[model samples]
Target: MKNRTIDYILRATWQAVSRMYNEEAIKYDASMAIAFALLSIDREGISSTLLGPNMGMEATSLTRTLKKMETKGLILKEKNPNDGRGVIIKLTPLGLEKRELSKAKVKRFNEMIRANVSDEKIRHFIEVTDVINELINNKTIFEK
Candidate 1:
């Protein structure tokens, strides 16, 4: 059934994500890596709270990851001047370097996937994923 196929795809995606980043040994899980990647893409700082639900991560887990990253000098966390209660996370120079390396790894993974799957199928997969992402974003599937 179509639902089963989607479920399998989700499981496989998670497996691949976990395998790729979990071996880093830097306390960098897939979710944290993805969050760092997104921040790198944004180029500007982001609030810690905004990163949690978007990454399907809990606040406590995200806080722990941020702390680890901070200790590793992969990210800098500073009190938000506008809102003292809010913390802004930004990549340090070392963090940016790691982000660039992570981006390369992600690119290589995508290339491997493309090589294994036909272009047409890949396009369809991307379309379906986009639909799923839109649904998630709109809270049509999961409530934040």
Candidate 2:
């Protein structure tokens, strides 16, 4: 194509970043998905139902990831007393350690980007993304 569309650019950039993170994660016997799930979990724990939406993951996908984490002794699932049918996910010590690693990787990436890009440009990028999200969320991008 002579000109790349905005969605194409966004998708391509995300794919590149995802690949980079996954490569890094491989060294620790983890994947980008696991790191993301670790980062999404709160210290106090998060509801199994809420975690999926928070991470923008499908229920089945999140279930699989959580199962792997559990098998790795990275997370613990406990029944929610208030809601018997619900489960709360809490991180283990190993999970906390991994979470720090994920945080550092993200922080380093942000720092590297900040070192190369001007704050004004970053702010503009954020503003544009915010507008895009708003448009999608409001269903304003297409006629009903």
Candidate 3:
């Protein structure tokens, strides 16, 4: 029963995230968009190889997404000065702007959800989410 409930919750969460992004703005591959959002917030540039594992993406998928982002002028890939073998990924100004817009939209969506949901339920949901995140992090359960 507990396992079933957890599985249902996980599926629901994924569906909600996918729907939220798909409905909001330009239609993009959700995973790639998520990667872009992470890069926008990452002060230090990230490596493509590191990103692929972190995002649970295959190397080829990451490469394709990076190429599209580069063509769109959303990101710049440069040789890492410290590690010549690595490529550093950084968001361009346009990418930063898009990220900001997406962040705002996400915030608004959250606000709407909060307004509709009871405070007690919202607090419980937050607590459950935090616990799940902690469990995944502590156990290193997520695919890399």
Q: What lDDT score is found at residue 76 in candidate 1? A: 79
Q: Which digits, one per residue and each the tens of the lDDT, describe model 3 over residues 78-120?
A: 8988898998998788767666766777777789988999999
TM-score of 2: 0.96
User: Model 3: how far is 98 from its true place, Å?
Assistant: 1.1
**Regions of model 2 farther than 4 Å from truth:** none
Best model number under lDDT: 2
Q: Estimate each model's TM-score.
A: 0.72, 0.96, 0.70
Q: What overall lDDT, based on C-alpha atoms, would model 2 receive against the true structure? A: 0.95
lDDT (10s digit) by residue, model 2, range 33-70: 99999999989999998999999999899989999999
Model 3's alpha-carbon lDDT is 0.72
Instruction: Give per-residue lDDT, candidate 3, residue 23.
Output: 62
Give the per-residue lDDT of model 1 (tens digit) for 37-96: 444434577777677766667777777877777777777777988899998888888777
RMSD of each: 4.4, 1.2, 4.7
At residue 98, give the lDDT of candidate 3. Answer: 63
For candidate 2, the C-alpha RMSD (Å) to the true structure equals 1.2
